[model samples]
Every structure is written in structure tokens, then in C-alpha cells.
Target: MTPDDDELTFGVEEEFFLVDAAGELVPRGPEVVDGTTERDGELQRELISSQVETATPVCRTSAALLDGLTSLRDDLARGAAARGLRLLASGTPVLPGSGHEITRKPRYHRMAEQFGAIARSSATCGCHVHVGVADRETAVRVSNHTRAWLPVLLAITANSPIDGGTVTGYRSWRHVLWSRWPSAGPPPMFVSLEHYENSVAAMLRSGAMMDRAMLYWDVRLSDKQPTLEFRIGDVAASAEEATLAAVLIRGLVRLALRDVAADRAPVSTPDEVLRANLWRAARDGLGGSCLHPESGELVPIWTVVDELVANLREPLGASGDLDFALDVLSRLRSTGGGADRQLAAYRRRERLTDVVDEQCV
Candidate 1:
């Protein structure tokens, strides 16, 4: 990879739920989003009135990413507090509530009307990381190379272990819930850019997807930007965790770009195997086993994580993020990541409120 490739800009978009003091979701997304002023990013409304989303400015360094995320989160938290609600970063709500209201946007209204229950029930939160690429063709080719690593990333960032006041048993219950959408899940391996566009055309013609924006695959070429967006993981429970995910994703993308330049063929893991591993990652997180991306054998999750990090060592080091990435990984290993931390908090008093209380900060 060229020096320029190592400096590809990236940005992160995080979605959060607004909750009252009792740990119940509240329909205050518009109030919180409008009330907050972002210094280096943008805060906007999500599909549900109970959710708010943040998009950081294009960032060229890990430090900038951390600052943007911290600033935006603080703004949202303060705004939510002013309205007597808390900005929660968990992937799913911890306590059961009546239901969430759809946002007032015309598009959202149509989604609610057309998608019905699926749209109404999708009050989930997730972290989407966007990395700059040369063009749509590059994004499609890089996506092929990066497909195997998506599940490994999900295993690391699984934070939605509880939903509706009960332990849902899956580390990322949001992933399972998100799969209800007809166009959601891992993207099919494409042979070329034309192949990718044809697939999208077919999905639209078949009514599986309403538009390009509904391409809810784990990784997809952005419809609005010249970048590849990774939508695999749940929204991380903290800024550090989110930053770790971004740096790791950028490294993977950089490595993929190099492979593309060299004309190296992408790994051809079977589509069924990719979907199965995704489910396994969402279920276990970092606590149990996952299928190795290369060998397709069930192994300790950390083993797969280590192998991924090792594979990206060169790209990460080239980008001057190796030390920071290692430090974050070390902390995650010690604290057991977001899902583990939330589980620990709940087990302390067997109170789901504790999980909400701990993650909100």
C-alpha cells in the first residue's frame, strides 16, 4: 500500500437510545437532537423517536476520532439530561416499555407504514464505520476481502446482551433483531462492480429493498458517500470501545486495498458459513467460541481475534495506530468488553437497571 493509502480518512456514526431515569425508553429523540449542538460532528434523529444518531466529521487520526466521539456523546448526554432523559449507548433497551414512536420524517412514516411491525420494533442501536475508498468499484472489491473479518469484529463489539428487562442470551440481541429486515445481513460475494449493481437492482425489483439506502448488509458501499460502510457491530458501550472498532476497521480496509492493488483474490468462504459464523458471534461475543475466518473451524474467540490483529499489524503500524489499538485491546481483554461488563453489573444486584445505569455514563 502507498503512504497515501495508509492515510485514508474515516468517520463513525453511532445511534443511541433515550431513556428516563427508570431505565425505560422515551420518545424524546427530536428534542434531544435539536437541543444538542455538536462542535465537530452532527447529531440527527433516527427511525424511532426514542433514538438519536451522531456522525463524526471526517477523521484522519485515532486521536481525532476519540475527540469527536467524546464531544458528541457529552453533548447528547447533557441534552438528554436537560429533558430528563439519559442517552444510552447499549445496543438494545434493558427494560420493557410500551413501545417506541416512529420519527416524524416522511421517509420514516412510509417505512412504518410499509414495513409495519419490522419498522416499529427496530428501535435498536448500532455503530457504522465508514472508510474512504477510491470509488464504488474499490469499495465492492475491498468488501469481498474484508468479509471474513466482519464476524470477528462483531464478536469484539457485541454489547446488547439484554432486552426488555431480561437477559436475551445473545451478546448482540440487536443483530438477531436486525436480521428481520429482508435486506439485512451479510452481503453476497460479488464478482465485479457490475455484479454488485445487478444484485441491488434485483433486490429492488423483487421488493426486498425499497431503495439503495436499505442495503442493510453487514458491509455495503455507501449510497451517499465514496466509502465502504461497516455495519456489523452493535454500538459500543463507550467511546474507547468505539474508537477501537474504527481503527481496526480502517486497518482492515487498508489491507484490503493493498490486496486489490496487487490483484490478489479475496477469500471465498461459503455464504452459509459466513451467515452461521455471524450468528455464533452475536450469540457468544467474546465469551465462547467462533468459527475461524480462514479454516472455518470453531475455536476460542480470542484466537480468531489474535489472528486478525496479527494480519493487520502492518497496516495498523503504518497508520501509526498500532500502540493505541494494542492498548485498547488489552483493556478489553481485562474488562471482558461491553457485554461482559454489562452482565457483571447486572449480576451484582440482579437488577437490569444497573446495566442501564452503568452504560449511560
Candidate 2:
């Protein structure tokens, strides 16, 4: 592992949908990306023409992360408005049109051609947290160590309940849609770097994925960056929520690295157990049971989250993130995840436009 000062850094990537004056999905990604004033390569056009993405510079502190994320979000939103569209942070469009206009990029076009219907029908947006690692071996260890808790993170960040103009009955309908991809979800335990590389190479050779970047494991070693990319949760509704997710993820990675230094193997769970837990998280968010990572027993979601907070309290505090994490988790628990808020809006107005408007605001 590369030796350095005790500081660790992370970055955030968020994907959003574009909406028109009526809060309906609009295919204006090209316009927004072209016309955005602050074009520092932070803003990007995504797969769907109605979707856009933003990434933050690497940040060392939670406060910096929040500030950077908010600034980028505001700048990107303003750029969208200039194109006569609103930037929406929702995971799935409540009223997406029949057409799935693919972005005019060669890689995306090739993906659309190769994957056919799955590529065309997918418009799910998500938030990715990239936590820096010392090396590839460390990245593998951290990923294995952190896989069990991803479902808890998903429950906390559930933001897509409605998709295709219907309440899909899951808190994160985006997760369900994304799971249709060939290489999306929790990865199996990788005992060594050799095993990890070989597995990914085999997948590439099988044509299951186009390249290393398309590995799409919920958590994997990023090919282009020296970090572990966490692709577990939906795009958060607010900047604070996105930063909160990043903070918690950083804390988890720190804890995992500590375990690795102590020569401890990551707590292992069966693939079936992990998949079941992920499904439960998507279905119920914080409103139902969560599988206990240590015992393989079902417990109330609050219990699982509380235990996670307790376990990471010291690491978060040491990095000056504990207070912010506590505040965010408390508010999240009280108000429920974004999906709950969307449902509440839908119940009050009986209109998907209102739901979209609430998300945009």
C-alpha cells in the first residue's frame, strides 16, 4: 500500500433527469451540455438524452463535499434552465416519454446497439461515490469488506418509487431496472487481487460487458481511477443527502482498511443472503426488516442502521464527519427516504407532475 499522511479523499458523481416547464421529461441533454456556462468537464451528457451527470472534485472533508456538490448542482441546474429545462435529481422519470433517445456518442450508441432493448428501456439515474484507495489490492479488500453494508446504504438513499407513471411498489424502482443489466449488483467475494482481475477479464472476454468501465458491479475497483466506485444508491434528492452518503461511505472504507491492516478477512455472507438483503432494501427501504450483516438474521431496519452508525462512529469522528453524519441520519430517519416524500406528494396532489415538481425543487 502506498504510504501517505492519514488523510483520505473522495469524489461524488450524480446523474439527473431533465424536465420541461411542466415537469415532464425532456430530451435536452445535448442542449444543456452544449450551453452550460461553467463547462469545466464536470458536467456530462449521459445515456438518455433527458439525463445529465455532474462530478465533484476530490474532497477531503464532509463540509467541502457538501459545498462542492451544492455548487455543482446549482450551476448545473442553472445551465439546464437556460436550455428551458429543469434539472431533476430523481432516480427514475415518473412520466418518461415512449422514446428513449440515446445520446449521440459512439460508445453509448454501440452499447445501445449491442444491448438492444435493455439499453433502450433503461433510464435509471444513480449516485456513485468514489473512495480513494492506496492500491488495487487495497481496493479489492475494501470492496469485499464493504459489500455487506451496501443494502443498508441503499435503504437510506432510496429515491425512486415511481417509474413509468406507476408506483412500482418498491422504494427504489431504479434499482430494479438497473438490475436488468448483465453486470449490475453486489459482487461475489474476491479473496485476492488475482481472483478479482481474472473474474473481470473473463467477463470482458465473454462479451457480457464491453470493457472494464462497464463492470458495473455495485462496488468495484475503478479502472480509470485509483478508487473503489460505489454504485449502490439512487441519486439523492438534496445536496446534503448526497454528501451524507459520501461521508458514510468514506467512513466505511476507513473501517474496512483498518480491518485489512489487522489481517482480518471481511465478514462473509452467502450470495443468496446478499441478494435477498438487496431486494428487501429496494422493496422496503427503511420501512421493513434488514438482514443483520454478522448474524444473517432479519432485524428492523433501524436496528441495522443504528448498529452501522455505532460501528463507524469513531472513524467518522476521527475524520470530523460524525456530527454531520448523525444529523443527516436523524433527519433521514424522521422524514423517511426520498421515495417516501415523493409518495406523500403524490398522495396529496394525485398528479405525477406534482411529484416531479417536488423532486425538481
Per-candidate TM-scores read: 0.98, 0.97
What residue pairs clash in candidate 1, if any at all?
A: none
lDDT of 2 by residue, 174-275 (tens): 998999888788998998899999999998898889878788889999887888899999999999999989989988999888888888988898888898
lDDT values of the candidates? Answer: 0.90, 0.87
Error of 2 at 181 (Å): 0.9
TM-score, predicted candidate 1 vs. hidden true structure: 0.98
Per residue, candidate 1 scores C-alpha lDDT tens digits across 113-163 of 888999999989999999988578878889999998888899899999998
- The number of the candidate with the highest lDDT is 1
